[model samples]
Target: MSEKKKSLKITDAEWEVMRVAWTTKATTSKEVTAALNEKTEWKSTTVKTLLSRLVDKGMLGTKRTGNKFIYFPLVEERSSIEILSQELLTKVCSKKVGKVLESIINDSLLSVDDITRLETLLKEKQKTAVKEVPCNCIPGQCQCHLVS
Candidate 1:
């Protein structure tokens, strides 16, 4: 898949449609619309529009099943989240990653088990953490040059 496909930008409405497709495996536009209608005030046409946009964005794959089109997610939820997380990190200074992580941990309501899992992940990541993280900035976008 292309990088653009890997990191497809999803809107809130598109996410709602993707969630239905992901959970249901392969579903029709009517099914997606009905599922979303239970929780949202959106009309069937609005849901259909979101589904079409998702397919166009390469986030959803479509196949004709008789008179209806079945929709399935081309991108898994976990993969999409990972791409979004990496993109978010790219906007911030590498040196502030730890601080950002600390802020996230402090601001969120994590259970004891979640905290333990995070600690384990952190330990594993520390094994691969380099002493110096090289800046990938073009020129004046960040303060990496000012530091040295």
Candidate 2:
């Protein structure tokens, strides 16, 4: 897939539609609307619009079944979250990644097992991390160049 397609960002409403599609694997728009109706007050039209936007964004794939379209997630939930996380990191100062991650960990309700797993992951990542990471930001967008 193209970078633009890989970088598709989902909105809150789109996420709701995606959750239905991801869980169902393949479903008609009507089915999705019905599933959403249980939790949301959204109209069928609103759900359809979100589904169309997801398809246009390359986050979803569709197939025609009879008079309805069956939708499925083109990108998995974990993969989409990884892409969004990377995109968020790209917008921040590279040197502050640790600080940002710490802030996230502090604010999140991580279990002891989760923290232990994260610590192990961090140790593994440290082994392969480069001594220095180059900045890929546009000129004047970040202060990396000024860090000397």
List lDDT for all candidates, in order.
0.80, 0.82
Off by over 4 Å in 2: 1-5, 38-40, 128-139, 143-148
Expressed as tens digits, the lDDT of each residue in 4-96 for candidate 1 is: 324547886787787788899899888887888878978878888988898888888999978888888888888877877776666677777
Model 2: weakest 10-residue lDDT segment is 1-10
Candidate with top lDDT is 2
Q: Please write out the lDDT profile of model 2 over residues 26-140, one tens digit for every residue.
A: 9877888899887887888888898899999998999997788889888888987887788777667676787889999889999999989999999999999988776666668
